[model samples]
Target chain A: MKALKALSTSVGSKYLVALTGLSLVGFLTAHLAGNLLILLGPEKFNGYGHALISNPLVIPAELGLIGLLLLHIFKALRHVLLGRTARPQAYTRKVWAGAPSRKSWGSTTMLVSGIILLVFLVSHIATLKFGADYPSAEPGVRDLYRLVVEVFHSPGIVAFYVVAMVVIGLHLRHGISSAFQSLGLMTPGWTASILAIGLWLSVILAGGFALIPVWVYLFL
Target chain B: MKVHLKVWRQTGPDATGRLVDYTAENIAPDMSFLEMLDSVNETLIARGEDPIAFDSDCREGICGTCGVMVDGRPHGPDSCTTVCQLHMRRYNDGDTIVIEPWQALAFPLIKDLVVDRGAFDTIIQAGGYTSVNTGGAPDANAILIPKTVADEAMDAAVCIGCGACVAACKNASAALFTSAKITQLSLLPQGQAEASTRVVEMVDAMDAAGFGGCSNEGECEAVCPKGISLKHIATMNREYRKAMFANR
Candidate 1:
């Protein structure tokens, strides 16, 4: 872990950023795949929820996820603050000054997107993760399926979720490939393809999350 | 050809600066960007005004000295060429050009278009060296370096330390500059002995100098006078990680 201790430096912190970001991407993928169970109706969704909480690994896995999220946030905040301190005097008139295809906008706005995501994450946890519980739809379980359906039913909450997803998407646009480059995973021949995939993944991942709320609100 | 210039002028590091307009008349198309500035400076001097103070050495572009933001692009609108080598032909006649010093908190303005890049020297002093003692030179072929490695090392070595990369970076990050030195030395067998300590020390120095971390934005590579690639930064990232992780 001495090596990891050294990673506490700015560049090393970047690797931590990439690692945590990738881990969160994994978390998102699994979360979405599991969320898909809601489409099978409340019984299956609630059953899935009960099964998840019943597993011995569930509590530890949740704790690990929280750790990853906290680490990601801490690193991001440190870098953002360092970035601001680096250029105390701002440019008077500015242009992005990079290739249009490989936009720097995403890179520059990461701090903003991160703040938005942090707010959204807090609201998400407060509203759904620890909000009021209904009587069991399944024996010896909270009616989490009713909660999901009820949560998405509100147009305002659905709208908030969609907007937050877009923010998350924007963060991922730069975060994905940047992480790879920071970790030295990029090669000249593969950079373009990797970036292209990163872009598509950003859109798909965010779009997938946004669709769930809308899908449940409308048809389910 | 003629051009209108809006140049940033400041009396000193703490003095207020502003973009003031000037005109260059009858400039030759073939003249380098710095040459046109020379004409403008000459006119200013003739009028008993202080000429713009900018840094330049080895007008051929290798010294890594002369640099300014012309129309928001570092070293003027030219790619892979320093301001001293950037031809006036890249601009149309009657074009308006805006020039500013490398604006970073870490680089305080000396006067006019020159800023003190002492932070770079500080970062260099932190580790940008191999500690071989003076002795008889080793045989040229004594240490075998693969052709690919020699080429790659040369690629990183091509960095002129112009500060253009930092100036052009949105966050004013010095990642490109720091990594260039890291990649250049860390690739060699002579440098390997101290790679671990060097990377950690250099990066700490860089951050302490108040330079931002690399976002891998590629802006620095695009405007680099020496065509230094982002790959060097990537390599540094890898090397830095290995140095840190392996230390444990």
Candidate 2:
């Protein structure tokens, strides 16, 4: 019975969302760390990228990361679908009040922001991983370092990336703490602090990602 | 005080509704929000027009019957008070108030501000109870409860099941309303027997009724006439999570 409950489609979707989302947040932290290596110039950045690709567990780990991302998107889209079906007919003169009225502009646009991030991720992997045209520092290795410098040199691409990272920042502001609340990881005493942490973490992560692009574009 | 009003009017369950304009004049400042509505209805009645239908029972705010979105706020502008308890003096002399029903898919409009809240009752019926044998009651002290736990449970117990939480929620989720019942019983010793079953059945019923999932906006607690805390929602999540691991 417990297993069935665990397996039920609707039984624990919210917690599923929270758990998967938190892992995705973890992935973002790791990815950000890897991205910041670009600030050290091509040799270091490409070295890190090459090492990541050459690791023995890379294939399995990559597959696991993909699974996590899929689950996160799946649970999030499920909530969106549920919310839509729950109110088939739109309200005529609807207005927000109390806490509902207190939503940030980013909180209100989570779906759109999330979709933007999804598009950015696919294009990002394609360009940085498979789309690199330059050769490696050592023979027969991919020169991801050259690609990084060249790509950030473009004004349009930098602009796109800057905007996307900020949206990610905004999304995380509400999302991280909200995931905690969903998972019941809150006490009255900790509520404000949890939310505060989410906000600060968002600013840091977004700021970190945004810094890399601008740095590569100008200083590099 | 005289006020301009745009009230929603729907003839029946199947009828499409729109906001109809009316001017209320010579309204006394001491009158309640519902009384102001009565004055407007009176004018329409004098012209042989169908009176605007609204719900009000126990106009003291205890019945959870009188509810409307006054100027886009549920139960009017006064905090922690229902429409019946809201006074006319809160509005300016020539203010235009946009009155609409508590709109949600679960609570469909019957007419005007009166929605069919039968969905709430259905959810309650699904579990919201213990299966203690029906007979002479046991001594109250037989199941001793701590003061703080009892008080917090009572706090959750105050929900009027008014559906204001649903209407106030952006997603139209009934998590607050449903959680109130779950938290109320799940805290009591007598309710421990069926705790697992109750949470599952009630949540299932809530989902089946087409209410949206809770995103913890906290609007329900803010707009609640009873000032029900979001702590109950946390308790509910705890209960639901436990049920997932411990029971079917």
Candidate 3:
């Protein structure tokens, strides 16, 4: 137990967080790319979704993705809680010096956003992936593509999705650069490139995810 | 130039303290902040009052002996310079400056503008050195360290053990100071043999001394006299993790 606690505080745990986080980001990008196919209308989009879910390799991959997400969030929360416990006086002081340097506002708020994202993910999977209220059977299936479109048609749902995506964007913006630095990849020349890539990835993920709801509500 | 000063005054370590106001005039812009305080002390001595007590020695900024909170900043308004290196030009002629000792549980007030930074020395003594022998120093080229590794180690070694990093931290964390020492030694071959013991002892000492854990606020780097990077903290974290597993 002491070793476990020490592991959470150690630098190796930082790498674990970074690697798991990177995998999650990669999943988000691929998921968003697939979702964007909905813009082509039901036939192309639903068929694409059907094709993906039906693929022989996809079931295990999805399960693996879920495992990665859980592990990433678990480790992140552990680090956050340990960090908080280590310094309980932070919130009371309006000003403090000698706090750890190299921390950013985005990095500090990651756990909050991650929790919010978890809530968003549960609602998302429940409604669309589980086909809870959709008019269809299990094997042959209801058209998940149409269900997604209908969900996005509601302004409230659309707004919630947009807000969630914004949180995700903020999380990625900090998490990406920090992950690389934690893995000992921070060279001066490479730092700018990594940061730029991280920023671009964040913008694309957030913008892409938010676009789905906006497109369905406005045009579809 | 003239400035209004609100300096903390205490008769001794056990005495109560208060902010005392003084007007300093005709201060040269080129004089470092401590030299200005020296001028003020000269006046106080002439008037037969006890002069303000502060810590300083090696006024060139390398000794890490001088530090004060000026206008709520650890080492004045500079980004990465010590109090002894900060020039008066950074302030307006009539500016009111507040100066006080490093405020932390571990750094008790020794007097006005000087706290007992002995806690840091204690932490250092706990594990900040290598056990390598001093018998006939090894050849300079014998080590053959990579340029990158040498440069990084040198960067960590530049830290002067000043508590400016702690004074600047919101949590008063000793992460920067402790990490700098850890990284400096960990990067060399001579220090490798005792690395695991060094990390565990140093970290335990840091905690036992009541220094707060790092919150990653980055203020320490901003006020570090040597511009020590936060990368060293990350490095220390890595070392501590390795030590834990290796020891177990």
Off by over 4 Å in 1: A1-5, A187-190
Candidate 2 per-residue C-alpha lDDT over B76-123 given as tens digits, one digit per residue, 9 for 90 to 100:
776789889999888889999988888788998898878998999999
For candidate 2, give the lDDT of residue B121: 95
Interface RMSD of the predictions, in order shown? 2.3, 2.7, 5.4
DockQ of candidate 3 compared with the true complex: 0.17
Off by over 4 Å in 3: A1-5, A10-16, A43-105, A111-132, A136-139, A187-189, B5-26, B38-53, B98-119, B134-152, B169-173, B200-218, B237-248
What fraction of the genuine interface contacts, i.e. the true contacts, does candidate 1 reproduce?
Answer: 0.63
Poorest lDDT segment (10 consecutive residues) of candidate 1 chain A: A95-104
List DockQ for all candidates. 0.57, 0.50, 0.17
List native contact recovery per candidate, as a fraction of 1.
0.63, 0.44, 0.21
True contacts kept of 3: 0.21
Model 3 per-residue lDDT tens digits across residues A1-220: 1676554443545667888888888888888988888888776776787788778999899899888888887777666655444333221112434343445556667878988999999998886888544434445645776688777878899999999999999888888877876655654557669878988999889999999999899998
Candidate number with greatest lDDT:
1
Clashing pairs in 2: A99-B219
- TM-score of model 1 relative to the true fold? 0.93
TM-score each candidate: 0.93, 0.95, 0.77
Classified by CAPRI criteria, candidate 2 counts as medium
Q: Against the true structure, whose DockQ is highest?
A: 1
